[model samples]
Target chain A: MRQINGQPVTTTNSQTRERILEAAEAVFGDNGYHDAIVDAIGRRTSLSKGGLYFHFPSKERLFFAVLDRLADRLVSKAEEAAAGDGPALDRAEQALRAVLTALSRKRRLARLLMVQGYSMGNQFERKRAEIFDRFAAVIEGRLREAVLNGEMVEADPALTARIWLGAVNELVIHWLHAGGPSPAQRADEVAVVLMGGVRAPMPVPMPAELAR
Target chain B: MRQINGQPVTTTNSQTRERILEAAEAVFGDNGYHDAIVDAIGRRTSLSKGGLYFHFPSKERLFFAVLDRLADRLVSKAEEAAAGDGPALDRAEQALRAVLTALSRKRRLARLLMVQGYSMGNQFERKRAEIFDRFAAVIEGRLREAVLNGEMVEADPALTARIWLGAVNELVIHWLHAGGPSPAQRADEVAVVLMGGVRAPMPVPMPAELAR
Candidate 1:
């Protein structure tokens, strides 16, 4: 096994990466992307600049890695809430609630998730879309079930998922960046507006006693 | 009257500004904020760099001016569609259709409104928020009547308008930048999802007559 500085290179390299990401999240979350410095992360992780660069080459890559971890955490929360035998709509709500609750607990997490990348432009926008799409896929799967179970009117699940995620994105922006009500408080209302569109259409009544 | 180039200052000043805005819109819309050259706008307007600088001072301001003009056009379109004795919900739909139809007719206009300034970051995002808020207020006005007239289930008109606008914004973005289907094609479905949420609740039953 390869050893560096009397430690296994493989294990320490991963541990160092995990450490760097944790510290980077705090730094990035505290100061935002533009204000943050590599040295600050290096100091936070007890690594030299050379060591930091050895693991992740640039600040942009490091920042996005932090975002990926955050996104992965949120996606799992959404999927876990969405899983099981519950009615799909309720599960969808649970997924929404899970995300909102998690965000509400940590303002910094919310900022990192929604606000930090505003300055980074195209790459960040694409990343935001990718993360939102990940969340949408989880919800879209549940919504497809909701439709199949006759819980909703016939509607395109893919489009509905995108729209639903968009509304949530707006709601979070209002709460976090725009000085509006917290999303947890507004979660049900958002659901009503978005979900109402899909509520099952008036069921087609079977022809009543046509034989008569 | 102050005249440097043989034209009356006040009359030509306003006309010059108007001319610059028109030419700048074409340039910025075609090449985006970063790629579009100020000199291109100057050339298109038959004005020198000094003449162009005489009106708007910087490219950022010039770009925002174009966006503001476009947003104003959209805002007025929404208000006009909403300005009738017909049902408010239909008016909202009309407003949505009007905007989407206009956008479908011109990809560049849609790009200018929804896609450009995307790379410019904070200033652009703020401008976007401002423009969206303008559209939201117009729709909110109609939705207020929609709620009062029992056209929708009880909903916060302000929030509903924001979410509705957010959905439309996302649709346009997907259509323009993300290779998604045209928003014009999905306009009705967009309406169903967002409007469904605000739909008026099932009404209270009239009390049985005590006289009976």
Candidate 2:
């Protein structure tokens, strides 16, 4: 049995996989998606390219795996938070705040997931969408709860959820790109704008054909 | 003189450079930054790579030049709209509306400027900052005028401007990524949120921290 990072590789493939992922996250975050290489990821675990491949077939697969891990963590946290005893509005805010804190601490991983996610297609994109859908589901559930609780007016919960998600993602990207303040500040601002609108929907102009 | 895009290429070096920039915008919008090439840009005007090189040494430089042109146009439009005859609030809204419209119409350029801008450093970054600063100045001026004219409450004009800019940019990215309905709806929502406060600024946090 080969010894790697003071762990016996033969004992558990799952443990080895976890280590490889952690290493991948660090490399991808530090050097960016375009610059990170498989060799670099393997070196962190004192493993060869073959060892890394045994766990993740390609960098794209590894990237998606890392993203999946983060997304799952977010979903689990949101579900757990939302299910907790609290006001609907407060629950939503708490869930989002947790997400922002997690993202802030994992700046490199967050950046990679965002900037590269949009450009990636094929298998990588499938995983990205899955993660997005998972988060969206949580938001939708919270929105439904809000509507039921009368904390928010009845509207398209899914659409509203997507809009909130978009706003949060955009704020993070700008924050990352500009090297501005912490994500907490951005999260607070986003929360304000999102929750600021009147409980009533604004009068939107309808197209002539639609009106007819 | 050699034939160039069926034109005589008689304009001054600077003017010809400007013409090439205009053409590049049209071409880049049709294609995309990574997919766009110098030859396609040359086909739009009487400028070869050699001639273009005289002005911009590389494809990336030409792309930056295009971004510069668009930035200048937006800033100039904002300046004109701000200085023109209208209510201070109306003028500020008009200027922002103009910016949002321009960004939506030039989606490719907006994406290029955003994605590539992050990857650039040193001179390119400085150039990008210079252009962004020009627009920021326009926003600040109008904000100051709004407070002076009593159209808006007194606050940090600079911070207000950045917050608004950040919102618009975030919305633009969201609109693009979602492949959704008109951006105007979301843009209007943002404008309303900024113009008014969510929860009336909490009645005691003052308006400074709440502005963002």
Candidate 3:
């Protein structure tokens, strides 16, 4: 029933809500869940405590909202890459690269999601797993396609997807711990390692050895 | 210096301490650190609060001691497997199998270490990283030997080690999530995937004359 310029009041309220979430991501990313306070997040925005609370009922709610926004962005990027036309492995690699790129740009937020998010409580822990499951499903889908096309060997796509997800998560954790480098480059290396493996072929036995 | 059954008081105390840690592992593993109480662990044994406190100054201390014991057992098993005479990949697989076997038998404890422990606080987080580092180092050392002996392709041993550690950790996490099947068998499949990779060989082109 309210209007400002050409926009309705709900639009204005939604815009404000988005800004609050943006600030929440940075505050939660920087201070972690335990240390992050609502006041700190409010300071970064133009809204009052009442306005912020109107958008998010509590700090825990705000934290989960930020995580949800992050998860949505990441999952969409990966989905786009996976749905693109290319070799199955290449497309999967691109999806992974897209994920790393997005996370690197939001490195602090990435740390908050990977390290601090799960430990908050059982609810948050399950939420984190669900987010990870989305990523794993994308990878598993691509892996299944690769196998059907004969671009990959027969293997459990679900298990392989989980393994790949874990490897990528670990790499990101280490990268964050060491401070962010060019994660795009590291993503390429990870693709190679995961697709090709690390072992060298054993030398063939000599004729004399074979006789023995 | 009271004696028990002709044993020195110190020896009896040490035995009691070990018993307390064993019970602590199950309690923390089942309840996690926050929900886990000193009294619960005490009830699992014959120790009272006073007796438990005598052996472990605090619940956190008891929790760390249990983690340390778990770490020691895992590291020793990996070390023995790595030191055995065999191709490097085989040794690494054996080491991984040993880890999976140990973890499968103590599923609750493994969850405690991998999931709940890191989020407890900075101290536990740091301790978890240190334990992971030890495993990575052993893996790195074996990888170096493999490369030198031509059993593995040349690559960054340190990075590969970390990646391997991450993959194994992820697999265990998934196994726990899926409610612990025989992880030993899964470990073999993981080894094959890690060592040989998932990419299939490219098909050779047919001759032009044959096509005609």
Highest lDDT: give the candidate number: 1
What candidate 1 gets wrong by more than 4 Å, as runs, is A1-11, A26-49, A201-212, B1-52, B115-118, B123-125, B201-212
Q: Provide the TM-score for each candidate, comma-separated.
A: 0.81, 0.72, 0.82
Best by TM-score: 3
Model 3 per-residue lDDT at A99: 84
Question: On TM-score, who's better, 1 or 2?
Answer: 1
* lDDT: the better of candidates 1 and 3: 1
State residue A133's C-alpha deviation in candidate 1, in Å. 1.9
Q: Model 1, range B42-156, lDDT digits (tens) per residue?
A: 8998889998898988989988888988988888888898888998978987887788778877878887786566545445657877887888888888888888898987888
- Please, what are the lDDT tens digits per residue for candidate 3 over residues A1-212? 65658776565777888899989888877766665778888889856787688888888888888988888989999999888778786677678778878877767867877777644544566677778889998988888888787777667777777778777777777777655455666765666667775223335455445444
* Number of the top-ranking candidate, with DockQ as the measure: 1
Which consecutive 10 residues in model 2 chain A have the weakest lDDT in total? A117-126
Alpha-carbon runs more than 4 Å astray in model 3: A1-11, A35-53, A57-59, A179-183, A198-212, B1-11, B45-51, B180-182, B198-212
lDDT for each candidate structure = 0.79, 0.65, 0.74
Per-residue lDDT for A43-158 in model 2, tens only? 99888999888888788878778777877777787777667777676677677777766667767767766555433322243455567667777877777787787777655565
